[model samples]
Target: MKATRQLHDLGQSLWLDNITRTLLDDGTLARYIEEDSITGLTSNPSIFDAAISGGDAYDAGIHAKSLMGMQGEALFTELALEDLRRAADLFQPVFESTGHVDGWVSMEVSPLLAADTAGSIAAARHIHHKGRRDNLFVKIPGTPEGVPAIEEAIFLGIPINVTLLFSCAQYEAVSEAYMRGIERRLQAGLDPRVGSVASLFISRWDVASNKQLPDELHNKLGIAVGQQTYRAYRQMLASARWQKLADAGAMPQRLLWASTGTKDPDASDTLYISAFAAPETINTMPEKTLHAFADHGELHGVMDVDGGDADAVLARISAAGVDIDQLALTLQREGAEAFVKSWHHLLDGIAEKARQLAGKSDGAVLK
Candidate 1:
């Protein structure tokens, strides 16, 4: 069997951390789901920006929407929804098959609202409604402000993908917020089946600390962070609060490994894929990583529930003068800024497409 399926049977979900019109239109996304055992996909401003800016895949839609008098972010959201809805449909069976635990496609709120709690909440609701697919998740950052919005979105029954997390502490806070949302649902006599995933970014830790730490600790920080977070996740799931919620139909917010692609070319291609393996967790990898894993990945063993040597490894790095807590805050700030940058790129790409298509109608870039 393919290593992708091996991971699945080993209890870790392999999710595709990419989506594009071409992937959906060419049946490539479907093939990943069917053949590689990929259960879901995720998209963000950067991914969409690259897809729309790279080629003419979105040309006809740009023209169609512009012809209907829509433009800018408004126009782009429609175009994005078009792709996500189709992707959601492709995963509908998996969604149904797994009772909604798997088979999710995530669409993020405008990065412009990354710090506005109320604004993020409003945008999430609008996008959730606009998506019109049960399998679609509205991604909210795990920022301080995004926490309340996450709870509100979940309280309102919105499935969420918590992005931009960098540490075990951050993951703990987001998990608490998830439980709060479920508690509110139970209080309001509503269903407690709201699904969520606390996305802890990997690879970034390695990239961030690589230059700061001694060579002995190279590429190990990310794995250690993941181990620590996974331990917290397991503890939270087994807590009495979570058990009570689970008895009332609530699902544990699965830990998702994001930013799984290796940044340094010197590292193993499947570094994140194979190293972070744990049951009841999700690994969302870029398409390249997914293909690499399918081709040559190995599932050595799953992560230890006790976090194994995570604390000792972290202590060693700390002694090397790298403060994990301080660095986590810095990384979160930088990651939010990166999202804002990507959002602008996505909108700029949309605007450029609008102008080019208009110029084409007037004759340019195409005859």
Candidate 2:
């Protein structure tokens, strides 16, 4: 069997962390669902920026939206929703079969609002409303400011994908927010089955800490972090708080593994995918990583629910002069800033495209 199929059979969801108009128009996304067992997808400013600028696939859409007086975030949202709605439909079967736990496509709110609780909540609602799909998750960063927004959005019953998490603490904070929202909903006589996921980023941990550690410890920090976080995830699900919510028909907000693509060329391309094999969790990989895994990825077994040697590995990493807690905060901040940068680049690219298309229609070449 293909490793992808094997992994899926083991109960870990394999999601493609990418979306582009070309992927949809060329039927690549559908093919992934049918062949590689990809049940979901995710997109952020960086992904959309690359998609919009890398090809002419979005030119006609950009041009059309420009004619309709849409630009910037508004224009991008429309284009993103169009693709997500289509992708959501493609994964509808997996979504239904899994009882709405497997197939989900995520669209992030504007990264500029990462620190604005009100704006994040409003954007999430607006996007979810515009998306018009049940399986769509409006991604909100799990920053301090975003935590309240996450809770509020969940209380409002908006399916949320909490992004930019880097540690077990961060994961716990967001998970608490999700439960609080569900608890609030139950108290207020609302449905408790709001879909959500706490996305814990991997690979970046090793990327940030590898240079400070020895050769033996290189490329190990991320998996260690993942193990530790997964341990917390298991513990949370077993907690009375979660069990009460589960008894009330609330779904456990799943723990998702993001940034699974290996950043170091010296490492195996499928390093993160092979390591993060566990049931009821998700691993969203770059398209290249997805293909590479389907081709040659190996799954030994599921992760250690007790965290294995994660604490030891982390301790060694700390003894090597890395402050794990401080690094987590720094990574979350840096991740937010990086997304903001990509968000700007994405908007600027769209504006430029609109201008170029306008010039062409007027029979003048844009310089």
lDDT against the true structure, each candidate: 0.91, 0.94
Colliding residue pairs in candidate 1: none
- Superposed on all Cα atoms, model 1 deviates from the true structure by an RMSD in Å of 1.6
Residue pairs clashing, model 2? none
Q: What residue runs in model 2 are displaced by over 4 Å at the alpha carbon?
A: 364-367
What are the C-alpha RMSDs, in order, of all predicted structures?
Answer: 1.6, 1.6
Please provide, for model 1 over 1-367, each residue's C-alpha lDDT reduced to its tens digit, 9 standing for 90 to 100.
Answer: 9999988988788889888899988989989988999998888988998888888999999988998999888998999999999999999998898889998999999988989999999999999999999999999999999999999999999999999999999999999999999999999999999889989999988998999888889998999999999999999988998899999899889999999999989889999998988889999999999999999998878899999899999999999989999999999999899989988888888877888788889775465
- By summed lDDT, the worst window of 10 consecutive residues in model 2 runs over 358-367
As a TM-score, model 2 comes out at 0.98
